[model samples]
Target: MTRISQTTRLEKVEHIVGSGSGLLDFAVKGENGYDTWEGNEDADWTVEDVDSVQNVEEDRYIMYPEGDYFICEIEADTEERNSGPVRCWCE
Candidate 1:
């Protein structure tokens, strides 16, 4: 007989944009190390994962490790609000 073991690790994360009123679109680097942008129909936003995203604090949001890393791109109506490539380590 053979035995195998596996572990699932999760961490907290936050999405920070220059200027935005609501949750911005986001994606994460899966364990396989790939960015899956299959978030929304437009592929610009992700469905809210209540379990992962905990709370919203001003310009920052609290999320968990649904993936290895977090990534987001935003196109705001104002130049000051426009931001992109906002990423962070979820591990």
Candidate 2:
């Protein structure tokens, strides 16, 4: 079995609004037939992989199970309330 970990920084977060509130949906790719986990307390989030096989390509993923996560910022709604670019590096 190969252990591969991936992380992705959300793009277009500025265009993604907070709906007059301070929240947004964040997404990450996972592998199918594998168990995955997520948390907000880590500097870099981690997920567990338990797959017999794996395959991945650019700009797409196949997570056996699909889910959604959230991020709540303290910024208010304004023209200048846009956030800076997010950077992600995975190995």
Candidate 3:
């Protein structure tokens, strides 16, 4: 017979909004999944990875690892809105 054991790690991070048009940026290279919130829901928002920044859209984004790690950046049309703490974890 064989036995296996596994463990999970959780990491939480909060990012404050500065002088920008409600833009939030962060890198998620070693996390399993993450969620972002605290922004204008009506305003035009776009979410993109480090590879794509010029794209635009209107939606909320929650990121998950799909075999590769990536840095996500979100931009909103409104400003002065702070991004709440983001929670991420790995299992």
Candidate 4:
């Protein structure tokens, strides 16, 4: 039997916002945090990949109307104020 190897990179990641409808594509962000990776104003603030309401501290994420997802690092963690760069919200 012959074995073939393929490169593993840029997998599609879906970060579900408050609801499970909104998806976040890590392709534009480079997978997970291993590779650090945009943006809107007056847009709604949302969280993705949250395990549970009690576990909101981890897996912090935010999505835009244009389906752009990003890592939202809020200073207070109580507000949607981001302290880091976000995903691309292209319209």
Using lDDT as the measure, which candidate wins?
1
lDDT of each: 0.31, 0.24, 0.30, 0.30
Q: Give every collision pair in model 4.
A: 15-24, 38-86
Tens digits of lDDT, candidate 4, 1-91 = 1111121222233332322222222323443433222122432434444433322334544333324443343121212222223332222
3-90 in candidate 3: lDDT tens per residue? 1111222232221121124333333334333332334333343322322223234532334332244323333222335332222222
Global CA lDDT computed for model 4: 0.30
Q: TM-score winner among the candidates?
A: 1
TM-score of each: 0.27, 0.17, 0.24, 0.19
Task: Arrange candidates by lDDT, descending.
Answer: 1, 3, 4, 2
Model 3 clash pairs are none
What value does the lDDT take at residue 66 in candidate 3?
A: 29
lDDT at residue 88 of model 1 (Cα atoms): 39
List, residue by residue over 1-91, the lDDT tens digit for candidate 1. Answer: 1111111122232332211343342332333322211112232333233336544556655455455444333233332222222233423
Candidate 1 clash figure, as a count: 0
Better of 1 and 4 by TM-score: 1
Candidate RMSDs in order: 14.2, 15.4, 13.6, 13.6
Arrange candidates by TM-score, descending.
1, 3, 4, 2
